[model samples]
Target: MIRAVPVLLTWVLAAGPAEMTPLVTEAVIQAPPEELWRVLTTAEGVLKLGVGAADIDFRPGGLLRTAYDPKVPLDSEAAIHTEIVAYDPGRVLVTRIHRPPKGFPFMNAYARVWTVFTLTPEGKGATRLRVAMVGYGPDEESQKMKAFFEKGNAWVLRELQAHYPGGR
Candidate 1:
């Protein structure tokens, strides 16, 4: 039997009570919401983004976990613990990262972070894809950590684009 691993959900308090600093990006996909949603909710689908393991339940209060390859050169593992904070089939998918993977320094030092994706209809055959991430960090170093993710998210979507023809 294929044992299911818990997926990472979104974390709303990573930095404390400070205003949520969000990194937002949007894309217009030729595919329908159903197609996009399918890819986003699948394990293989999310792996294409160059991250670690991804398993999300797609339902509220469900388990969500994402882990990166230890072989990667990045200082932090690609793993992120989260749960299905919210979901709207064919519309929005949101996950909050609660647990950071092992060997990741400073995993327990900050508030939590949450990621949200919204799909809007843009006509007869187009979909507007909006991805946003909000998390907390206590000190400047932590803030910088969040900043790193702010920038990395762009590349994350770019990787996603590669899966989409003409993304490069």
Candidate 2:
């Protein structure tokens, strides 16, 4: 009986944390890391990347507020607001959704997700850019969000790659 107790305790101790897999996308941008970092952290850069309008506070704990409609003012409730977390000048930028616009999907899951953007210098000044959406729980809503970003993030990465040489 004592041997069985030890075996059961060992099994329980051997169990690991819950599976947490991020949706990751990587591509080589034709620009250097410095240039790409600017594109990621500035309001003009956001607009150039096909976002309509942006008001960016480019600091840790600051906000990146954006609206998809050019005429929609940024202070309006229609804007999507994300918070800037820790960032390295030209290497990484981490952020999480602060306030999503109305009607945003997967409301139950969005609160827990964070995005990490990493830029690495590759051959000939090209930058290897990686985008990772992390912190997804194993719920149905999270699964749905996972499916949405699988297509959405890949498209954005492709666009960002094609958008190099100039941020347009």
Best by TM-score: 2
Tens digits of per-residue lDDT for model 1, 61-110: 87656666635433344556666776778788877656666655556433
| TM-score of each predicted structure versus truth | 0.72, 0.83
- Evaluate residue 116 in candidate 2 and report its C-alpha lDDT on the 0 to 100 scale: 88
Residue range 38-76, candidate 2, lDDT tens digits: 889999877755678898999878999998898887777
Q: Which has the greatest lDDT? A: 2
Q: Which ranges in model 1 have alpha carbons more than 4 Å from their true place?
A: 1-15, 70-78, 105-110, 135-138
lDDT (0 to 1) per candidate: 0.65, 0.79
